[model samples]
Target: MFSWIKRGLLVSTALLSIGLVTTGTDYREVYAEEPLRLSKSVYEKPNIYKVDESEYALFHAVLPSSTDKYIHRDVSSAEVYTNYLLQFAYDMSMLKFGETISKQIEKPFQDEILPKLSEVVAETTNQLTENEWKQVKLSSKPTNGSGEKIFHLYNEESGEDIFRFHVRRDQPPKKGHWFNFHYHTFLDGHEGHHNLGDVYWGKNMPPKWMA
Candidate 1:
């Protein structure tokens, strides 16, 4: 009887360890259970616009003057152009959500908001001219609670990524349920662009659209 009880305990312990290794360790299994369901509807129109040399110069002037060696040499020409697109999205999200939006809302935005945005931007690509940014693609499966979306804005012909945008969102607790958003742009091998700040929407956040 004693030997049988000891064996039973050992078996139970082995099964518990196996369950932890299989279920508790793999993130994919967890995500599968709560599978992200991104909607495919467009919430707002894509605001496609151009940034000429003068506009670019004005934008550049506002950035912090950096004497860093990487800043001087590695800034890509395409980055100068894509900055406008990033700015457009940032401005529009702020206008729609209000001015005090926080980072905490990023999960809801990803699960409930970004799918529609992905569709709108993809559709808008057809209308863009050769000189405009093209082939905008989501770079990876956005993770929940990450507060950001990663995108690769590719060049028209070369298929190379001209720039990538890391768009982050948050909503502070007890802050009227508002959401804040901002993005950092990386030009291929270069560090992120500077001086661009965040936008917010507090207390006046629009109702979430249900599909």
Candidate 2:
């Protein structure tokens, strides 16, 4: 009879907690099953953008000044490697050409130069181990507004440039002007010029870079 009375008190306390068998007014509104109300939808944020790594293109490059951002030793993804390589090249090109020239040359740069970027980046990164690949980085502070120096990919530890990308305004005698895109590799002592093709800008002299 004493054990039965003790069990009755335990069952009564459990029912009183969740408003199912409320003992007072305080417990009446404290039902555990009711959902909490919200002022706004949880997914309604204006500042968020989602990027898909698989379908993503290296169309525009951001965060050019990031320093020594390693690619990580264990990552062997081609998308990760090419995205860094191509985007940095595009970023440097934007810095060199600025708005007007970069827009006009975007077509040729995308078609002609992007292929070379893919080809060369694949070739180079394929030959290296993941540790060596992670050491490679895109350097910052490209020559601004003018000059052929866009940027270079370098070894963060050794501070040596592996590739140098450049652009130059070309005018052959009696020919239309062109913006020439090219790159140099350390293997050739930076002497050999590997062309990435050019965009014709007509007979008139184009505005200076970044103008």
The number of the candidate with the highest lDDT is: 2
Tell me the TM-score of model 1.
0.26
What are the TM-scores, per candidate, against the unseen true structure? 0.26, 0.62
lDDT of 1 at 179: 36
At residue 123, candidate 2 shows an lDDT of: 61
| Model 1 error, position 177 (Å) | 3.8
Instruction: Encode model 1's per-residue lDDT on 12-102: one tens digit a residue.
Output: 1213533422222101100011211222232233222222224234323322222110111012333222223333443334333333232
Residues 49-161 of candidate 2: C-alpha lDDT, one tens digit per residue: 11222332321121111322444333435644455456556556766677777767766676677667666756655655656665676666567545788777777778877
Instruction: Please report the candidate that would top TM-score against the real structure.
Output: 2
Q: How accurate is candidate 1 locally (lDDT)?
A: 0.33
> Model 2, residue 207: displacement in angstroms?
2.1
State model 2's lDDT.
Answer: 0.55
